[model samples]
Target chain A: MTAAGNHQASRSGRRLERAGIRDVAAAAGVSITTVSDALNGKGRLPDATRRHVREVANRLGYRPSAAARTLRTGRSGLIGLTVTTYGEEPFTFTEFAYFAEMARAATSAALARGYALVILPASSRHDVWSNVALDGTVVIDPSDHDPVVADLVRQGIPVVSDGRPAGNLPVHAWVDNDHEQAVLGILDHLADSGARRIGLLTGTSTDTYTRLSTTAYLNWCERVGQEPVYEAYPAHDPCAGAVAADRLLARPDRPDAVYGLFDPNGTDLLAAARRYGLRVPEDLLLVCCSERAAYATTEPPISTLSLKPGRIGTAVVQLLIDAIEGVGAGRPVAQVMPTDLIVRASSQRRSTRTTVSPPRSPEND
Target chain B: MTAAGNHQASRSGRRLERAGIRDVAAAAGVSITTVSDALNGKGRLPDATRRHVREVANRLGYRPSAAARTLRTGRSGLIGLTVTTYGEEPFTFTEFAYFAEMARAATSAALARGYALVILPASSRHDVWSNVALDGTVVIDPSDHDPVVADLVRQGIPVVSDGRPAGNLPVHAWVDNDHEQAVLGILDHLADSGARRIGLLTGTSTDTYTRLSTTAYLNWCERVGQEPVYEAYPAHDPCAGAVAADRLLARPDRPDAVYGLFDPNGTDLLAAARRYGLRVPEDLLLVCCSERAAYATTEPPISTLSLKPGRIGTAVVQLLIDAIEGVGAGRPVAQVMPTDLIVRASSQRRSTRTTVSPPRSPEND
Candidate 1:
């Protein structure tokens, strides 16, 4: 262990009461300003003097109070990550692969910049929101009239959202995939693979992701002169997804290809196809938006529309931190990240194609 | 919007500057103490008076300073959740099914009690740890001599871990599955299914979970007079798990059955089995520990040993909160949670099995 580690251990063991900054100043025979400047890397000081003050502080177990620091600096070095839900239950960030991956990347990015992410709920009690001093916030999917976002923005706190804001909601910045372009690309890919008609398994929620993807699907169906055939479910409910998949497949005029908007839709549709004895790619093509690595190893390897949540998460944190630190302060920045379509056996019709594209490396995503 | 929501929306829209408590008290025509008491549901205040004060404060968009409140009450509603990493990179809580599910449950449990979770790295810089005032902390897997846990404990902060502390490390409370019993049960289950030999895929890290599970496996092998055949790798790396799985199957003394200790091992092992032209449950029986729902929908529906992370997460948070609020002060508490084995097609022998156990409902866990 380093000397700092050893000093910390010894101090933790021997010290019965917390040490204050005054003790460090007195023991080191240095003024309070010198100690403060040395510890905070503020005013100029000699390297030897700074090291001597730090060593004395560490030896004395002198630690600053977070409350005092926050009050003094008007900064907490904390960023809020709001999990938005469309139902009564608060959104658990791990419910979907997209959220899980996004949160992981966000945490990494925040830590890289010496900030920590606090998990907050969009619909939590007002006290829950106000109990922590956050420099900025990253809301997953703000509602059309999300009161929490409105409140944060009103307080002049920089708020960056993972999904595009709905209605006239205000956010300092946002990072989101091109939902319309991604959906259109998937529909075209399915069509190119000999899909006569493509249906959609979408969410009933009005979040920007769901609403935009569903609208894109409908617009594409209209432009291509095919009637829209789709089923909507409460995406938060896992069983509802399976039941909705069954309903989509059970339709008398069931489309030959299906695109799902949520993470678990691919498996739900696969199970539903099994129930109806519909072979994938042969009878129906399947695709869904997911960040789960398990999909790559699934039987027949289901095709997935990768939202590149890691990139989005990293970008959101960078924007939020930039806003918090007064970098790029004027105009709110909205970045549109590209999506990846991981083509797999589930989406390819083996019997119809004369030329086949080689499998793309998963690392490209 | 309700009256409260409408007031908040209006206040946020019109207020150019933040409202102080003094302003709220003056506007409400009440003493500062009276306003505070009414807003906090304290003191001898009538229901009508309390309602009036809160309404006035809401209308004025008066939010108490978190730093001030924290200093005055000597408490912060923020709870720290430390994510420990064994490799160089910081642990991403969503990397595995166990962590993802555990964190989800922990977040829900904390929110239920009006607390929010803050994600912190176990190896984060000291300033990061001191930047937030946390009422308590929940360490996922503390090292044998984790300096962070020691420092937090020394500061009179209550810490509850999700895994048993190795060596003589101190923690306020801990919640962990009975690893020895769980591993023995799985090995015996495999034996009962007419397996001649069973191999193991485990991690090289010495965390309590891995240490206890691996020790149990070795002890079980010694008792049965069978040489232990296992492959150990750094579990944090996904590609390492795949390579390790392939190596285990390529061994000259490869066991007829294998149990993997990580979430991704099931799919990795299955893929390796295919390379060897082996059929699941016929050529090799396979099982892995996981909390993922995808395992049930795999090619042959892989069996899994579930650590019941949700239960452990809830239990850990409950214990930490109890310690923080002095629910059961003094004696530290240790909880042993139960594990569930979800038997699926991959772990069952088709031809050798004379009798079959009915499928257990997943909700029983």
Candidate 2:
């Protein structure tokens, strides 16, 4: 008897009604071994035979049970991405340009490695977490001693984080931009652009990014013998940002140059500057941390601190997949990437025209 | 003997090493029935007991096996969201404001219903598809005869689409905007604004939205006895949009007004109009279909046709989850929703300024 017949005899009493591997072999006129090899790309076979077997299986609507496959391989090929939410809805986290860009790159990187990325809220219900079998997880901006991160670590699931974990949160690996260094560089750039005092538009969030950047700004101010001038607001609330920007400009001790720590701050600051009758690069210099392309086309295109979210996204996934596959089985891995300073017309005292300007058009501000 | 003793006696041989309900029962000094009731939110259980049981379970790092649960309950609590990609990466599809808003609403809606939404590329490989056990799926703008949709339907998976299915493709349910009516309304609005000649900026894709809108534009032109003048480009290609916008303006018989069918068309057409020294409203009226808030703050605040993507997203998920739960068992559901026309300065020849303007800023144009 052939191997196909033996296989059929063994499982016929249990699952004969469903379209099994035996059914595919019989339909394609191939042995069970040949069918298995063709489906899995295991053994060397003719291209035509493999295609034929796949087509036959597809026609029969033969699907390998995900649950059964999990039992056999012990891998679900799923990576959970925990997004830090600022509002009740988890999707509000992606409203920022930085988060959106980072997520896109991470999704692309994960897909290229044959794993599907699942977006799970950081504050997801226990049942939601228990329903999906994740090979590992990637946490973005984990809070200090996050319960979710702690639970996952205790469960032995490898976790890679986009932002450096605050406090003593245990993470398998982490990829983050050098936030302190990036902030200092931006402050220096504004100082060199002939600004008397430099100010900061920052967030009240306690996440590592906001905290680190604010600290760096304060340190820079102290080192330069200048008092820090800044306004802080709840970044997640859309209306609060504009009010804070207006308040900053309304201050009696307003700084000549300002840097915003969030994405929408560029526009908010620009509108504020207009209300004060201050032209960019003349009375006010503007810069913001963002990955939005719209800033490149703004009136007097705004200077921006590019966190290079794409690189961070790719690095986090690579480190995560490596930890999952046990490529580097040692201590935790930490990667800190450099930031890019995109100089534009808004940040310069004199129009050097260093960057390529758009097509000649009437400037409307 | 008590129920807890019987349960422990029956399962002690197989899973004594692992933390089980018996472990929780013994630790909390409760019956096994009480532990199960507290954990599942079933039966009359005090809130304190439920919280205590949950804390113990969390501390023990005990997770219900997703595979075993699937076998027992036959539901995974997972919903697949198939995003139609315009490029190689699935993330590019979310670059549009309409899509981003729609997805956000869908994610919010799914989470509210106790289901975690998974972002799956519409062109996902077979392995990716078969690796997750999804109770239902939400397909966004399914192509005519989409193999993925067909395969899912064959496997008895419920699929609810955001757009109407092309051809005779079988779908469990669908929700779509009134695209033809939306187009006709926008054309009439432009004509009413004293536009002698109006043109359209459309896409070359054969999807239902593009096809319906384009056909409606053509029919409107015929009704007005004006020769059709429009530019069609591959909407997925980012750079192609700007080139097409410029091409439309450079024509000898240039249009006095134009309506774009995509999101970025507002910015692209504005730049093109500037290059020709054509002022908005005075020379060339502009409008585009978008859900972007940035358009509200543009120099001449461009008019926009809002497809109300949030409503559509919520409706699609509601229909899908309803079908998944076997609620309202009947024929397939089809919902057509209305669109909103936001008339801004760019669409009006003589600015009546009916809408409340932003805090007056210096206009350089």
Candidate 3:
């Protein structure tokens, strides 16, 4: 309680705090800038010098002040990854494997580059969004009139989106799969499998992926002189997918082959086939867009149009980081990643070729 | 440039800046405290007056400064959600359906409390963790000697763990399932279904879930006067689960019934059974702990012991928020949530009873 005690208490408070960068520099007998460069792996520093500085810092247990660094660099070393939801469910994170896989890859990519990701909702209030300083953002499937994307653009935050932005929403960069080409490839694959009448399972959503795939399918159906036999549903609802698949199969003029747009449509359609006494590949050839490994284990593995979410996620983060670190910040980078069409029994015609299953065979000894 | 042009440029620059809390106060014709209260849904205020102030603030596009608010309240309104990794790979976010569901519930619960969750890694370096100011942390399966959790606790930040801490890790609160009770109940279920010898496919990890479940399994086997039959492997690797499942079935003393302790164990066990020319219910009754709904549609529909991740997530967040808000902050809060056993064709005796599916069936005319 005395003046001397107060002085001692203040001194103890200082001791309780972790060592700072200045202490590291003093301990290393180097300039503060040299310590910063050595720790951050930046500037031209000899390997020996960097090692020596790091050892000194380690010995002192000195941690550089992130807040001080942010103040100096005007960067928070934080990336915002936005997930848009159709309803009030908290973690549609697993509504589909695509979003979960894409996010996992993006988080991995961001962490590798000394940055951390903050998961924010697309419908986040402006106050919540603006609270933390973000160096950039990755918007997953931003719609044409996304007010969040627009707001980020206005605030001078660089954005890289997973899907192609609709209506020319000026994001700094964007990465998406060639959906049209993928759909057309599926159509050709089906046609080659001796499909006279091929149907489509798509979504009622106006997102670019659905739009492009549907347009491509309609165009293919017209060129092939086949009537468009397709069913559309709200893609966010898994139950809706099952219902739609059933309706498509129950139609009076059910097509012999079907291609679904969403991830769950494969299992839904397969189950629907079972209910109607239709055999997959023989009675109802099937293909769907998905990134799940579970497809490889389905009764007769269902073929898939893989968006290669990992590649897209990695690319989006790379572009966003480049923008943040001032690399190609203004180059208007737009990347188009490729899709993979994994062949399985569900989509192959009855006698095209002998199918080899995944490396596991259940043949008893 | 003319003086008039210079003045105009400076004025425009000021205009381009976002409206601050002060602007809201001025626009709403209220004091700054009243404006803060109105926006944050705090304090005693008439509903009509609050609505009027909120409308005025919205019209002015006013945004509060997160940094300033943190400094004033000594709380950042941010929660840190740490995901422990098994290997060098970045995303264990989707490693299990449990994590995805838990995180979803946590995110929703945090958002409901006007707080946001920040996903950070358990192995994050000091520089990265120290940079962000956090109100509290939710650690998912932290080891006893985790430096991150220790650092947070030493710094006087509250930490609520999802899994029970291995040792006295000094967490402010924790929420976990009664793993022992759940495992024993699972054993009883299989026994009631006429399981003479119940083998286990478990992980070699020292995590509390594995430790408790395996211990309970051994104890139950002893109680029933049966020899322990089990196989252990690293649970993080998806391929490892399949191999372990095969190894268990390949054992000379292969039991007629089995329980798996991981998410993908059901399918892996089923595949292993097929490889050995074994029928599911007739030859090898099966059960696994998982949160995946896909199990419902698998061949013979696998039974699952759901840990109720949503309840755990929500409870963890509520405890963390209560700690952050200084409500029962000093209270020793530890909660145990119940588990759900979803009976399916895989676990029931062949002629036990008619099984009920989930509450959805496509209404067909």
Candidate 4:
């Protein structure tokens, strides 16, 4: 066996002559054994010598083959972010904005703690759970009994979610806004304003956030003993909300107040109100759940339940980093941050509007 | 030296006991010589034996160790993206959106050709060009006489830039929108509208896009024989644009039309117009360059010059993939696509008379 190993080393050495241990040793002014010892962390070499050898190897543009490294470490810094098909929903600008914000936040946080975030588009061609060389994964919008989540857990990769779904495998950690309480708060605010009939506009039922918001709205209506009038759009774009608003408002029994589950949905509802000649508040009230920058500048500034997505993003990063460091593990953990309701012109009734004060000229304001 | 090397190897083996030639031989059910011969493509071996040996080693997760593998491969599939900082500019959102789109496109293209994109944020802590493990990098918004670009070239790592600075370099490939022509087109449209004095709302001077737009605005102003009244904002946010518009419009000789370099700038300008009691188009015409979704939903929809950012992203990916596949070398390539102007209400001034259509009764369009 020893003689056979010597023959194997000779053949391997010849094949790797251009980029072999000898070249690295020569570059670092160290023996081949020293270089080998430094890389594998063995053989009682001085710390400085090991550091010097490693630095020189890196400087010389050396990379251990991934296949070989995987065999040893059983891990890779890469973390896959599995997003549902852009084709399923056409990747709207709003989704793009949220993802961008989340990606930047996640990347910075990951790097600070020594990890890399690699986005992997969820495609049927590759197994979401098995193909990529990743240490862990963060999944967004898991469905009821999502196969992706199941397969990933079965493969033993740590999984964190943006929101929880009806899944058997215990979720490692999750960060989400308290949508139910947020909806109840909005409803209570509207009820206080003497809105007898309130209408609800929401995104597709597929998203967990939308479903949660809908459930909360229905519960609030039941508690208040009021008939629930609502519309769920097939998509999340502003156009969908606008069209839904038109249909809802065209009815003889129009809603006195409208609540949108998201920013685009809220913005669209406002546009539709203008088209229908319904003066905000006095004629029809409007409120949305997201405090996106665009909402703050729209015509009659929208009243929104500030979800503070940036804050949520920061929290998600902190949690992921903690998990990566092996600080938190075992059993599921879910975090819910408080939401703030921002009251603006859209929900302020004209009669209750203390002063018309020439719509605070955009320039002056 | 050979005896010393053997002694050190033996000592290292005793210290670590990590998988190496001996382990691969054991797993492969072959002599160590056969395993090495198969891996190196040196000594002749039967195809079936080589396949079986490789499969068994893979199953056993036997890594030759970094030192052993680094001695055989000189390249790493890591690519770097050098950005100054993630969130320093409001452009982060815009930049991130573009980058994500570009990344997705590049990933698909790179995989087809075999490469991976690794992002490395540019920081002041150290010269990133000197430290990252990368085959090549994509530099964004190069400053005039950037040393980083020079360092990358000296190191022989290929670079592709989104916007190359004025100073010359042996750039591998570049991709940029034709801002000069795009701005010129917007100016031509404004000139046709019979506007003599036009005000420009430009974004921060740090961006290459802003610099290009400013130069185009000045040149167009000179050619049309109109005063180039302009204000430069500190950032690209809508609030900055609004503040700039206020300063420009508040002057006794307020310009008739405001041309913003992008959508947020235009949105702010329109908002300022409302605040200043100046009706859009009638009192102050407005036009912007980006076709961001905000334009379609504004109270008075702002006209926009829509550039296909997604297409540009796709094009960049295609070019990078081609270069990686050895399609071209030592050849600097650049490509630009056309921009389309979508006219809307903000710039429409057929008549100034405020038509008081009956308050859109809840039933009207």
Candidate 5:
């Protein structure tokens, strides 16, 4: 053997000499097999003996090897939540809220099914498959050409995404809010409310939901035989929305209504309009595609397409648990929960009262 | 042996057979000694052989027994992050952002020093100490009688907290934001802005930071011989701020300025004030604690006390890493990063040419 091999063997011998099963057994005054049985909670040792053995083991700082136990049980009982690096900000408030909700839901689900949920932020440098200790992973922010999903698939790790990526991974499953239909519904509501010309304030172009919402807006404008005006801004910073709104509203033929792709953007647009002395739904109508907290308390509470974040969180957790429990990989499931158009003063053009839109049907989407 | 004892012995034997050194050796095409060396990454084996062994072992789902590994190595490369369940919603957003930032920093720090961070949600049902295989934990939202810290201490698990908990644990190291100074700074700015009567809008009374800020506001008001008109709302929900503002502003002797504990409350108050036709600063001045995303885009741009979240995140990670690396013990250490009050139109009196208050030493607090 090489000198390195000799050194390693000597180190192992020293480690064993420092603290071994024999040491634990000697300290407990029990046989090695008896100590093992007590440590594993396997045999029905006398209560006093079991207690004594445990106390001694604790005092001695003995810890069983996780690898050995996992191999023997065929289960790690560990669930991982993998979030990607979107920008300098590791995760947004919306993403954080979603993750917390999902983590709580998954934790409860894991407990019921006998497991633990570990929130793991997948690094840009490491492949998702490297997190092999996880029984399964709940992937968030799936891009069109996600390398993480590809690696996970290669290593046969079950993955469920918070949003649907454009990849054709057969064994993949995802849960998402229907942005296409939601945007269309918002546009329809604006048209029904007598908005002659409507402007769209969009989020970052790279996001799937933003792209999808933009497509739906263009399609709806075409169907209604109306010209669509829009301004795109990065979603990460709300300040970008204000800048976009300023540019869009400065035109000679400014829109009578503004539809924001998300809650923050919608709120920012409204704030911008207020700065410019334009009144909501009178001088300019406002609508947003998300139901985040800010939309509810704005001066003239901005109209929102309410996506049920908690419900989506719950569904994702259930799907992940199902997959981990050997439920046939979930059939490339794409479950889209519908969005509710909550009309508040910002988009309420009509003098008469109107009914709030019903909750979206999850099954239909 | 008794029949039950015999049965348990047979089951344990089968478990041992499934996860023995022989199994790993066979999977890796190496002798038991070579397999052990590769698993430990200490012996001189061909790099390809070591890589193949690790891959095959992972594929075969090898999990080294924690008991065995701990006894041999005297260490477990696990660090924990403990968060309370009370402020799950708002705290989730704040904590998740902080956690993600901390985790990223911690991951690099821990990996360099040889460790892993494991997130643990505070729970009464399951003992975090028993459930987690961690060398240490970073505690958050510490309560007077935090069970997680208590249990971990009883079990002798090293711990650090983001905030001070009620009980003084012997080995607990903690880091906290200087809320007292932050609140005083914002209030002082409001006072300098020609505001005679200042109102305070605080987060939920339950939060330690909210309580700290409220006390500071009351104390500062008492010292200045001014009546502090204040209202406390639940958590960080902007809707709560809107509701509270309705009552506070509707009063006959309404305060000239409102100082919010944080951005959401401040932004909400601004929105509500707009609904009441009270122009900011000219009519009712405003200032807030944290400069979150919403503050920059609000109408008349809300002035905010900017707490460096990224710096705080970096500090928390460094502290936790220090403890994990055995550089410190269970002692309370509070590190307060400086705060900057960014003056804007919301808090600026139109008559005054000086928008910014003169910079003051943060050490004054």
Candidate 6:
């Protein structure tokens, strides 16, 4: 062990009290500002002086107070991840594979950029959003008039959202899939499978994802001279999804093929089909938007439109960090990531086609 | 709107800067300390004074600096949730349904109590752990003698782990399931269903969950006068589980029934059974520990030992918050939450028995 190692070991043995910044300044023979600048990588200081300050600080086991440093620099190094709740749950964080995967990626990306994420609920009643000294925020599925995003932006904190903000809600930067294009491509795929009509299982909320996808489905039906067969539910309610799936299947005007908009729709549709003794891809074709790999092993693996939440998460964080760090200027920085359609047994009609297309990779612009 | 709300709405409309505590004090005609004490519920302020100060603060849209508040109170209202990583991924956060459910519950519970969770990797470089101000930490499956725990405890931060610490690493509190009881119960359930031999699929890691479960299986075999049969693999690798499951079934002395210790082992073992052309519950019986509901819809739904991660998560956060707020000091606070076993088709011999027992609930003593 070198001097620093020996110093750390000796400090560990005492267990009396924590080392302070003053001890480091005295030991390194520099002022406290120089010590702060050296440790925080702020201000201009000679390389040798900075290294000496850091070495002395480490050897003395001086942990600069994160709270004090945050107060001084006015940057808490904390990012708030705000999720819109659909019910009594504080956050619909685990409602689907998409949110969980997206959150995981966002956490990883934020940490890599030297910031930690704080999970904040947009529906909390007790000033939850204002309590945290967040450098910025990532709002998932912001409503048309989300007061949290409005307040944060009003306070001059950069707000980046995962979904395109509904209505006129303002965000510093937004990231979303080309929902219209993804829906259109899926409709085309279903059409190629010789379907006369394509029904939709969608959410009742007016979030941009549900709105855009629903509009795309309607436009496609009009263009192809087919009637729309769909059911909308309050997506935040998990049980409501099953009811909606069954309702759609029970409709007398049910289409031959259907696309569900949420993650659990694949399983819900399959179970509903089983209940009615409907054979998938033969009597009724099936597809859903999902991020789960479990679809790969279902009874007859269901084809899924992958929103590529992993890419969206990574991109959202990169943009948020860039805006925080004053990078990526001269551009509005809105990103529309591509979606992947993993072809499986459920979506393809066996009588008409023997060849299946491979997983469609998103065309990044 | 009332005058206070109207004042807030008007300030928000102007879109200027946020009001500080001093602004609140000036507006409310009170001292800064009086405003702080009243808003923070500190000091012996009367109810009317508290209400007045809060009203003034809300009217001015005064948001206190969380950093300054943290320094003043020695609490950041932030808890650290540390996940042990398998490899390059920040966390095996998506590795299993258990982590996802547990994290969701923890986040909800934390938010309900006016604190937010920070997701931190257990293996981050650059002083990642100490860089954020944390009131406490929740460590998931911490290794014995973890330096992170040591350093954190040395600094007097309360840490509550989801799993029992492996070695001598000290945590302020811990919550876990009784692994031995859960394993023995599963083994007996299989034996009662006409199993001549039993096998085990477990992880190669030394995590207390894996170690304790495997030891219980060995001990049960010893007591029951049956030869031990088992296969161990690095549970973090998704592909390794398939190979391990196959090797266990392909053994010359393969057991009639198998109990897997990890989440994905049920699916992996089922696939391996298919390769061997063995039908479930007739040629073989299977059980695994998992929190996924998808197991219910598999081809022959698989039985699972639910660790009751929701309860554990809620308990972990309760203990952590209690410690953070200096509550529950005199009581013996180490918790052993109950586990629920959801019995499905895969673990039963349908031909031999027409009856099935309900879920086994743990006795909390």
Whose lDDT is greatest here?
1
Candidates' chain B TM-scores in the order shown: 0.88, 0.84, 0.86, 0.73, 0.72, 0.87
Proportion of the native interface contacts kept in model 6: 0.51
The predictions' CA RMSDs to the true structure, in order, are 7.0, 5.2, 5.7, 7.9, 9.5, 7.0
lDDT of 2 at A265: 89
Q: After superposition, how far is residue B104 of candidate 1 from its true place, in Å?
A: 1.3
What's model 4's lDDT at A102? 62
- Judged by DockQ cut-offs, is candidate 5 incorrect, acceptable, medium or high? incorrect
| Ranking of candidates on DockQ, top first | 1, 2, 6, 3, 4, 5
Return the lDDT, model 5, position A147.
69
Evaluation by lDDT, superior candidate among 3 and 6: 6
lDDT of 6 by residue, A1-365 (tens): 55545555556657556677866776677788999899879999989999999999888778878888788888888898887775756455335567777777887888888888888878765555666689999998888888888888888888899988777777889999999999999999988887788999999987678889999999999999999999999887778889999999999987888999998889899888877778777778899998777777776778999888878888898899888888978245688988888878788876776444674422221
User: lDDT of all predictions, in order shown?
Assistant: 0.85, 0.83, 0.81, 0.66, 0.66, 0.82
Q: Candidate 6: how close is chain B to the reference, as a TM-score?
A: 0.87
Candidate 5's error at B63, in angstroms? 11
**Given candidate 2, what's the lDDT at residue A329?**
82
> What value does the lDDT take at residue B31 in candidate 5?
75
Arrange candidates, best lDDT first.
1, 2, 6, 3, 5, 4
Residue pairs clashing, model 3:
none
User: Taking the tens digit of each residue's C-alpha lDDT, what string does model 4 give over A1-365?
Assistant: 45435545656646442244556677787787898899879999999999999998878655444444444565455565655555532234566656656666666655655565655555433322233455677766666676766656655567777666555545578888898988888887777666899988876666668888899989988988988888878764546767887877776778899998766777677667767787776678888876355666666677777666555656676776566657776656789887677777777665453321223322110
Candidate 2 residue-wise lDDT, A140-201, digit = tens: 88888888889888777899998898988889999999999999999999999998899999
TM-score for each predicted model, relative to the true structure: 0.88, 0.86, 0.85, 0.78, 0.75, 0.89
- Candidate 2: count of backbone clashes, pairs at least 3 residues apart or interchain: 0
| Candidate 1 CAPRI category | acceptable
What is the Å distance of residue A97 in model 6 from its true position?
A: 1.2
At residue A90, what lDDT does model 5 achieve? 40
Backbone clash count, each prediction separately: 0, 0, 0, 4, 22, 1
DockQ of 3: 0.35
The sequence of per-residue lDDT tens digits that candidate 4 reaches over residues B85-144 is 644321355344456555555555544444445555654233223333455676666666
| Regions more than 4 Å wrong, model 3 | A1-73, A91-94, A329-331, A350-365, B1-60, B71-73, B92-94, B354-365
Least well predicted 10-residue stretch by lDDT in candidate 5 chain A: A356-365
Show where candidate 4 strays beyond 4 Å: A1-28, A31-72, A88-90, A127-132, A145-148, A203-206, A236-239, A350-365, B1-119, B124-135, B144-155, B203-207, B236-240, B350-365
